[model samples]
Target: MLDIVKQWAWYDWVMLFIRLISCFSITATTIQMEDYLTLPLWVVVFWEIIVFSVPWICLMLSYRYYLIAEMLLFGGLSLYLTSMFPEAYLTLLTPAFLIAANSAEKSYRWSAPITIVFLPLLIVLFSREIDVFEIFPQIGLAYVLGFAFHLLIVNHRQNEIIRKQNSVLEQYLTQIERVTLLEERDRLSKDLHDTMGHSYVSIIMGLETLRPDVASQEGTEKLDSLLQLARKGMKEVRGYLHQMGSPQDTLPLVHSLRQLGEEFQTHAKVNVRFRAIGEEYPVGKQVKMTLFRCLQESLTNAVRHGQATDIVVSLYFEPQQTRLEVQDNGHGMENWKDGFGITTMKERAAHLQGRVSVYSERGEGTIITCFVPRLVESADEIIRLFIVDDHSFIRESLRTILEGQRDLRVVGMAEDGAQAVELCEELEPDLVLMDLEMPNMDGIAATKRIKEKWPGIRVLVLSTFQDTEKAKEIMRSGADGYLLKSIESRELAETIRLVHRGGTMIAQDLLHKMLDAQSANEQEELLDAPNISEKDENSYGLTKREREILQMLSQGMRYKTIASKLYLSDGTVRNYASALYDKLGVRNRDEALQKGKKEGLL
Candidate 1:
């Protein structure tokens, strides 16, 4: 009953008020007419109180059956009173309207027919003393108003449901956008690492090889300058890759803010203090970003404009909003206008239905407070991984790369596949990254055992081999993905996520090689059989373009040379060669040649 009262809306309170007034008036009238009653006056008054109190108790307890019973009893009481004193009809109007409205709201089908029959019967009872025409219209109007109120309540509930659904849809869209942005960042990072990093390394190596060959002083000086430039470029590429792979994108609001403060303190050579108040709560990415930018801008202004040496950053997580307060101990401005940075911060907070306030004096430094409305949680489940590799350096490097991702955690590492299988049983990691060329119990055997025991766990093979047979074997052992050690760090991280999401991710080049091997094996088997027909000659499924590429490969023609002769691009020729390999069931050009000679196609 108390819980129901706590959840009552304004309409419920209004109904309660109306119910109270009607009960009091009816009881008061009963007292005034006690002398005309046949039963004892006290007995009638007590019965009246009990009858009125039942509806209130029913409403509170949400007992619909009892409330319906009370309605029937009240109707009988009203009919009895009208018989003794027709003037009692005036006191009955409010109670009749209340019953009709409450009943209709509960169920129109049950209440509508009841109201139509009961209200008119009451009117017919009053028709002896009052005109039937006047009372009938009044009763009709009450029933109409009660039905209208029911309609309004239904419409309000539907609107609430739609509003909640929209809120959920918006959150889903925001999450999708965030994931897409992170994937694009990783793609860009991988491209830079593969292209620019390789080019710089090559340039540095060639320059170092020619350094001793330079005889003149000027030539040596030039060579030395080139070496320095190449090294600098390589260093910059490494920095960019690190920045792109940073955990800032996935850190919680509090951790990200603390990191920002520490970075600011280190670079500005200023003393900084950080503190948080209230229980922390998860917030959306946009809200976090808004607060982050506000703190960043405040720190900059404190140093540049206020010349503040010491700074204090305070974060408050309240029920309604998340707040940030940045105060400095430097000189402050008495009459400061809104600069571009301050305006931008205000706009960002305002976009999230929040606000930014600034307070500054001549000597008290500046205080900037930003408030953003609390949003949805941004935490995701972490994926545990086990690494199986032989080299210590490779194991540590893999750990570092995987740990940089917010959702990925390297829980265990092993030097060989045997150790990996043992630790995996104990750790029960979500995913395993294994190398095929391990010393004891190679990756293929370990993978097979793991899948047999725990089919829920995913296995990804990260090896140096481009060997098609090994890839097929590991895959048959139930590895979810296969890739080479030459894969970019960013790509490796993304692939781990994809595989964890129940996707199979095979390296593109490895897939091409596997297809080539399968095609060659099939063609060789077909050609070795007897009773060969004209269709058997083309059983490899090679097109004219593919056949030409295969013949060029037989003549020791480079892809570039073949493309030039065939009036095709280098990429087109390579695609033709891949197709040719696929049709011949071969892994490489050499395999294709061996099969072609035995079949007399070359």
Candidate 2:
């Protein structure tokens, strides 16, 4: 009975209590004064018992049966009780009926409203027979209580449902996290085996060649080979570190193409050559990745579908645009309707604002060419910049150098982070060249505040020190780029222009030093903290692509440039940036970068 009551809604319980009270009140009235109702005492007792049981029966039954039963039982009882005993408290049954029907139905769509209207009409009809004040107020209060209880029960059930759904969602999310961790573990193990295994083998082979007492040419050659192997091993390890942190730090287009070529040669057993046709030029990361994907997808099709034995990937770096051609000596298809791979290839090309052309015939080899237009800031695109540094000479020097350019303007200057943030709000400049160390507030805090207010504002960090920790800190803070104080004026101007155009430029020397220092510290930490896994060390909950964007933004690249480089739309990039900021618990880029570095995400 208690379990059944527990299943009942609040209104059901209240209606049960009301029926019980009505039954007792009527019984007491009948016993104290048999003349009160002008009906037989036996009939009154039976009616009161019947009325008392109606709400309980209604609550226990299913919706369809409960509705029919409640109406018949309450309607018959109300007509009889009111007709026989006009002054009886049988009038209370009206509110109870309304509550029970609605509660049992799991909705108050019509029952409660109709009951309200019926009650007033009933009071009007029985105005002289019924005590106007007593019956009206009792019915009114009963209706109010019933409706309120019904509302409470509905809200309670909704809350319970929501809680249950939330629990299920949480469990799903937990499972997803576990899956992600497992995948990450698999990836890390593969990277470690591929990168470190080769280095260790080379080192071991070189060590085997060493002879303590030998002074022959063979021994000298062996020693030199050992030294070379050691150097190569160090380079490989550095490359691995870059992969863990920022791919753009070292994984350029040429490197990626070569890596892809090697992979094809190893797996497909095909002779592949990745050739560069022009002088090397800095292309956007988006263009590079797109070209890489184009090569990858085309090469895959050639090997799997086309059964190609040899392939040539040509990368053409033109003055205005970049072009990639994947030519394979494979079996050409007769009817070449775009399938999933071809469609995806076209989509990737289109995403870069590039066009893809597939030329294939039955006997002749297939050639896939993709041409992506490079985004270069035109002469008319002048970028407004603000400089914030404590040293008057540095600020003046930067302003003089930048303002001299036709496409650059120094809109404001500040000596501290506070001033920088305040001036940024007022000026709303396109870019801000900030110094990490300053009075009133530091660049880190200022960048965070400024970015929180104006997310679009790009911040470039200029510092004298090459401290990896500071660089990581500033990068984490959301600075788009970092530069050393020792930078040449011309180089500084070019870097500013590059960053303004949505390209990233970390002073190469600073990056190398930071990487080296970081690698060493990581080695030491690895030895000291052997239990720390890759995910545990750097799980700020960001994807590889997001970290890439964050790395670029830390180097002071703008959204448009990042989008172009990433081969994403401005809106997509903005959404990613916004999501990144949220995950890092920041409102702007600076804080995100700062938080990322602190959390080891950088």
Cα lDDT tens digits for candidate 1, 87-173: 655544554566555663446566555555565567466548866676656756776775566566667766754554453334334
Lowest-sum lDDT 10-residue window in model 1? 167-176
Score every model by TM-score. 0.46, 0.33
RMSD of each: 22.9, 24.0
- How well does model 2 score by local distance difference test? 0.66
Q: Name the regions of candidate 2 deviating beyond 4 angstroms.
A: 1-320, 324-375, 485-602
Model 1 per-residue lDDT at 375 = 37
Candidate 2 residue 162 Cα shift, in angstroms, is 65
